[model samples]
Target: MSQPNPSTTPFKAEQTFLAYNQTQAKAYVHGRPDYDRKLYDAVLQYHTSTNGQTDTVVDLGCGPGNVARALAPHFTHALGLDPSPGMVESARAQGGVSATSEPIRYELSTAEDFGCHLSPPVADHSVDLIVAANAAHWFDMDRFWATAARVLKPGGSVIVWTTGELRCHPDMPNCAAIQTALDHMQNTELMPYFNPGNILVRTRYAGLVLPWQLETPVPEFDQKTFVHRNWDVGEGFDNELPEVDLDRYETIMDTASMVTRWREAHPEKVGTEEDYVRRCRRTIERLLNEAGVEKGQEKIKGVMQGAMLILKRV
Candidate 1:
């Protein structure tokens, strides 16, 4: 008998992709998070060591071209690829360069489907390095690995990294407490959204191998995972939350408001915004209690810490 589908919520990839594009994505790029420059430097070093020179790098699952924009200076050429058209547009708008300057191109394509998208796809053995920043979760590892091998030249390598929350951000203690309380609730009451079934575990399988035999591992290839700690920085306040006019906070609130309005408009997208809102309010209340935020206090602040794994293919 054929195996039953593991997903219960009718896994329509296109819908999820579109929803991300329409709703949750901008917040992801703006609030999702950024990486430490040290990590980027280390990745560049690895690429240089492998190829003896770093020229062209490919950013797989490059949302908004954030990684590509960061690595552009280190390479002679860089390309950011993603399947979300909205994300591609955002990346282009943010990272687009003038014609006079060397440009980094952002294209829309899935990790496995790049073959069809790249008319004259990256020539075999041309790319010195391939980097997927915070995007491996959506990929099919086996096929992705095979495709990378096909495009990379001998001595080239692929690097995949996951960027999670910035638990260490000085102003994230409140956030941490909120998560703690939510965790407790999840373990006990276990709401439908917070249940184990709600968690989606995705991975990026990175390795170096030849094109002809996808299963055959390439010699001299090695892989290591790097642990990165991020500070919430309140979207860039790494050392501390910088003092600013109330408008800045209002802007953050505005983003939240927009998300709420969007959620309300499309209840089907977020799946019962009422429940999510209730959970969020409860989480905030628990966090306030944990942080000793007084009822009359005008504002509250706290800190958080989290980790990301970096894998080097060779």
Candidate 2:
């Protein structure tokens, strides 16, 4: 994967997604997969074991509050911060709150400017946990780490995780062929429109530039406490999920940032944004039919390989 130019502004790379409207935000809410419950359980357990408390958690770049709401039950207060007003609105609309769950608050602020905008200014060393789910790839890591180091309490945990490369199970007939078609569409048709941040996800987050190092001393976090793990779902790995039908799969594809960019750039190719989606759906359906997979009857089991990074504050 090619690296973005060093001088490219973060906004330039993320403007499309950040400028999400109601329709786009709704698509994301419906399409994106929820994090496996076991992943949350394990992370919370680690936080408890390491810090002995789960007081507050700040979720940066929290798109639609998926991670924040899912993990809110394990903490006292869960604050989701994002620069996108549409995402914040969508998250607020979803509104998952219960007696056991931390009350979720969605704030419109960039990760780099988060602390300064807080009502009480997120006092130094006060946050017990910080997380960035699939949204971290777009962050300015150096600035984020600096903010994290300032807000996190001693032994507080920072968890960053992202999913990569959707894969279909090989057992299904013509699954490989269907996957090939989809891959061609994504890699060949939509590749140019993909933002620079996508490289981090394509590498399963191994390409992320972390401030702390495991083999060497670092200032922001404890090198000894760093942990990296990969969960391969539905591929003889942990957290296997149910098969996804064609409709669900299409919805997921619609949430791709590349698709959005493509629609904006090639309005002449497709009549409208909705027509572009219909065209892609038709393409997928035709591929599936060619593979002898019945549209509504047959479902495709797939795996989403995800990487998790956990580090404790110094």
Best by lDDT: 2
Candidate 1 achieves a global lDDT of: 0.53
Q: Which digits, one per residue and each the tens of the lDDT, describe model 1 over residues 162-230?
A: 433212223544756666664564444333222111132111122212232334543333443332333
Give per-model TM-scores: 0.65, 0.87
Error of 2 at 61 (Å): 1.2
Colliding pairs, model 2: none
* Location of the lowest summed lDDT over 10 successive residues in candidate 1: 195-204
> What TM-score does candidate 1 reach?
0.65
Off by over 4 Å in 2: 1-13, 98-102, 213-218, 235-241, 268-280, 295-298
